[model samples]
Target: MELEAKGICFRYMSKTAPILNNVDFTLKEGDKLALVGPSGCGKSTLAKILAGYIRPSGGTVLLDGKPLPDQGYSPVQMIYQHPELAVNPRWKMSKIAHECWTPNDELLKDMGIEKEWMSRWPTELSGGELQRFCVVRALGPETRFLICDEITTMLDVITQAQLWQTILDIAEKNKLGMIVVTHNNYLADKVCDRVIKLTDINHI
Candidate 1:
């Protein structure tokens, strides 16, 4: 999926401060972009806007060169810091995985999650395990772009490395475009093809 944001600006009604100011960028298929900024610098907000979750107070977000469309082909997906929150507790692991089902039944197993774990509840899984599923679910067919918002922040360094490798492999294998939202400069440099500093935009 191709994405473009031009002169985007936004501010919360609850606060007088503006979060994003005249931000602009683009992500083409298989392009990996890292958004870096200090806390409260609008990284997550911009990610949400790009994912079509929040409407910008000004400017526009276009997906595939067209204005935002409702119920589109699930062209974009998000992997949040906490995967369990993204997964439903009442739903079985299989149901959660079904949200973005793939023909490769061995993918999760290859990620070190056993096939039997698919039957367990998300709450029963470890943080790292749940995160692997989150990547799996988002990378499944029908998803073309991913907004990864500090997805590995909660995992241990080892787990973070493993998960990052998995996500990178999947993105490369599928030629998926990705927007990596994070404050971790190291991870950003390691994962993204280009880095955009939102704090600099805030000053412009």
Candidate 2:
């Protein structure tokens, strides 16, 4: 499978300067690409566009040469930087984690998710813990391309390493494509097969 964004352009409003301009990006099965750029350079915007979370102002995002399906779990899944914001505050961790599909015990254990944590609400878990749930949920069987938009930025070094290892293992096992968005060069080097600076593709 391949996720491609061709000649993409976007801006929040008509009056504002464009966040992205003629951006082109691609990720194929087993490809782990890091998207790096200075802050506010529209890296996250492009990630969202690629994951079908937001429509681009111009151009198209295609999965295997067709528009992403509007209904059902997207083949392209995105794990955001802020887990707290991604999940429903009103729901328990179990509900949130299994909202799409129930992950097996082995998968949860690999992600460092404890069974005890499942009974609590989102606020009850720490950032790292909440992020574990987000990662697991995004790794459902339907997910083909994973867009990790600064997904480990908020974690401690230990947690960061652990999370990345788990993600890499899952990707390798599933032959999943990944687009990692981050400003950390060391992390980009450690996690991605190739790193592309957003400015190199974003004409703006």
Candidate 3:
């Protein structure tokens, strides 16, 4: 199975230059791909498009030769850079964690989430703590592909390693395809099997 972007093209406005132009790629199941590029080069935009969060001006994102599901739980899940922006401020951590499906104790423990933290609001937890919830939330059983848009770039080294290990382990066990989008070439090289520069694919 593969998550493929076919002839992808996009722009925020008609007058503005295209953010992405004729981009394409395929990430097979269980394979990790690093999408590396300079800032404002549309890596994150492409990530969102591949995850079905944004509609492309031209072309389509296909998962195993079919379009991504429009309703219900998406097999393609995206974890953003800022955990705080991803969660509902009014919701508690427990609710956010269980928004998709209730994560088992083992999974929570592996993600380094303490039991008590679930009861607190999003504001109560630190960035790293909240990010743990975001990652776990995206790991619902229905998810087959993950769009990691610099998910660990803001964390301390130790926290980044721990969170990434947990994510890598789970992805490996489930054979999930992952698109790791980032500007950090070193981190991308360390985590992904294949590295693609956005400039190489995006004509814009």
- Score each candidate by Cα lDDT: 0.83, 0.93, 0.92
Order the candidates by lDDT, highest first: 2, 3, 1
Give the runs in model 1 whose Cα sits over 4 Å from its true position: none
Model 3 TM: 0.98
Q: List the residue pairs that clash in candidate 1.
A: none
Instruction: Give per-residue CA lDDT, model 3, range 21-63, as digits (tens).
Output: 9998999999899988788899889998998999999999998
- Candidate 2 residues lying further than 4 Å off, grouped into runs, are none
Superposed Cα deviation of residue 27, candidate 1 (Å): 1.2
Q: Residue 8 lDDT in model 2? A: 98
**How well is each residue in 105-159 modelled by candidate 2, as lDDT tens digits?**
9999989899999999999999989999999999998889999998999899999
Candidate 1 lDDT by residue in tens digits, 1-204: 688998898887846877788888888999999988888778889988888888888888888778776774468888888887888889887777777666376677666667788899988998878888778787767777899999988888987887788778888988889999988889989999899888776644
Model 3 alpha-carbon drift over 4 Å, by segment: none
> TM-score of each candidate?
0.91, 0.98, 0.98
